[model samples]
Target: MTPPLALYIHLPWCRRKCPYCDFNSYPAPAAIPEARYLAALFADLDADCAFLINHRPLSPLQSIFIGGGTPNLFSPAAIAQLLNGIRQRLPCSAAIEITLEMNPGASVMAQLPAYLAAGVTRLSFGGQSFSIRSLKQLGRIHRPRHVLAAVRAAQAAGCRQINVDLMYGLPLQTLAAARADVERLLDLSPSHVSYYQLTLEPNTPFAQSPPPLPAADVSADMGEQGQQLLAAAGLQRYEISAYSRKEAQCRHNLNYWTFGDYLGIGAGAHGKLSTVSGGQVARVIRLAKWPQPTAYLAAHQSGHSQIAHQRELSAADLTLEFALNALRLTAGVDVTLFQQRTGLAAEHLSAARAGAQAAGLLDGGAAGRLVATARGLECLNDLLQHFDLS
Candidate 1:
């Protein structure tokens, strides 16, 4: 069976790219080329839809995530036009979740209602931290009060679904400060919270001029204690860094964790698609757009493919890819999904599964769900070493 489908639209222009950021984002010009970028997105989407006809099948979209340099930088009218254009090009579910990511800047607060009116059902604020010192250390533009004010504005606008992102283990951060961040976020009662640690990704400014961060053991303690705080606040830990109320788990991200299918459109967007072959074998294909916004737009205007990268997953590649995502879930995945999503033979992954289970990093057994133990979750990279042949 085909996995559920989702859509991810990347808007890659930010007012100023964050120093700690490594996403394919660039600083914006005085005026963003919204109309031109949108045209390119539709062209990319059209090509993807055509590929679906030959190698993929059209499935009504389950969710749409508008991520960005800063999606809220665009006006409500532009967002409305984009969403309407997408619906005309693809069939979306009646209850489809439409999420738009926004910075906690004061300017975006006034735009919340207009966004909701334009069909954005959920608003995810990049509130990173609540401490003034930590925000400055992370080079965030918004002050602590802006985060509180943004959530309040969302509530006042009658937007029901909200997600707030918070980072732990910052430069000079103490465990108490991390707890305070969680406590303040819980006060907002966001439906979902992405409580993640700030790691120095390669090629980023942070990686080059690494700051004096908390000690490794202290960071570990910060994560463990922070999890306890969120769990006690009625936010269940679904994935390692994600928590949500009983039914507020992010459906779009859940699809990714489960290795479901999704279409990626826009500069620097990536997508995965699945198809079954020989009535039993599953084959997966991945596609990515040009990372440079100008290059991508030029390719579209010139009628070029605009795909900077593309590949088909080998069996071993599929095994690792599936495990990488599925194991992030606290509850793990249905063992049967390996074959369904990857279209590979069971033996391809059984030995690796047995090895992890024998090491006590994994729970359950050969017949039921595959789960990661608490210790396994803590040492996820080490646990993955068991499955990584390369």
Candidate 2:
């Protein structure tokens, strides 16, 4: 089978770190050298191309995602240059989904048209909540009105696909408030919706000084209610935290969930590639770039650009990997997906399955694909721990 390839570019700088976010993003100070950053990104892509040449031929890039500190902060020219660099080194499909993440703020909102002109086919708005009080509590700069304006701007710019992100379980957020947020989000009529519960990640302000989130039962009720709201609006939950209209799901993210290959180029980017040793058994290799922006740039300037902190994925590791991602989807993957993606028997994890099924975590039988039974998805971390890499 041919290997599937995609490109991921990371922008490590953010205007400010959201109190609840623990992503590998840092606050951007004044006077960022925009030109230098673009040049570094281009050089980073160039280095990745050299590595791809050693393994398999470059397939047309099926997807390209320019993700945050905030990709919209960069000028259209800078973004264009980055895309040009990818095109020069790798071939791309005619309908390649090129997505850029933008904050629902004034400055980035103005750049929507220019980004569309630069070949951005999709725009995803980071509209965390519609509640003005919740927005202030989360340290978000944009108001509910700003989010509406941003969506309109992207639509007016002729963007074919638009995704709106919503957050739940905020401090002081009641079940009523969460439902209101969902109602407001559906009112915008976005092609895609991503609703995620707030988690206080380590090193984040909310983690250090924990907020009083809704209780477990309350959070579950809020999630179920929001899902029902989305369904009524003609959107279906494809994966945990992600919902979409017919044919509106983000292919770029689906690539990640299906265990496809992608080249991650940018600070703190991560990728998984399938390695076949010329007609022998194939192994899946995981690659990660250095996280720090300054350090990564320095490494790129020096000669060795890619810095993979980890590489190997054993048979047991691959089984766990496939189960962990595939099971997250509402429509569980086919039983054959295990052997196809992991090159292992589908029954490899049968022992774990029996335990999970007996405990009301997974379904039963051959056609019974593994999934987080309602209770399992809520305590996903605990379910995932059953197949620990260690």
Q: Pick the lDDT winner.
A: 1
- Tell me the whole-model lDDT of each prediction, alpha carbons only: 0.89, 0.82
Task: Give candidate 2 misplaced runs (Cα > 4 Å).
Answer: 277-281, 365-368
Error of 2 at 348 (Å): 2.1
TM-scores of all predicted structures: 0.97, 0.94
Give the lDDT of residue 14 in candidate 2: 83
lDDT of 2 by residue, 149-201 (tens): 99987887788699998989888899999999998888788999999888878
Q: How many clashes in each candidate? A: 1, 0
lDDT of 2 at 324: 83
Off by over 4 Å in 1: 277-281, 364-366
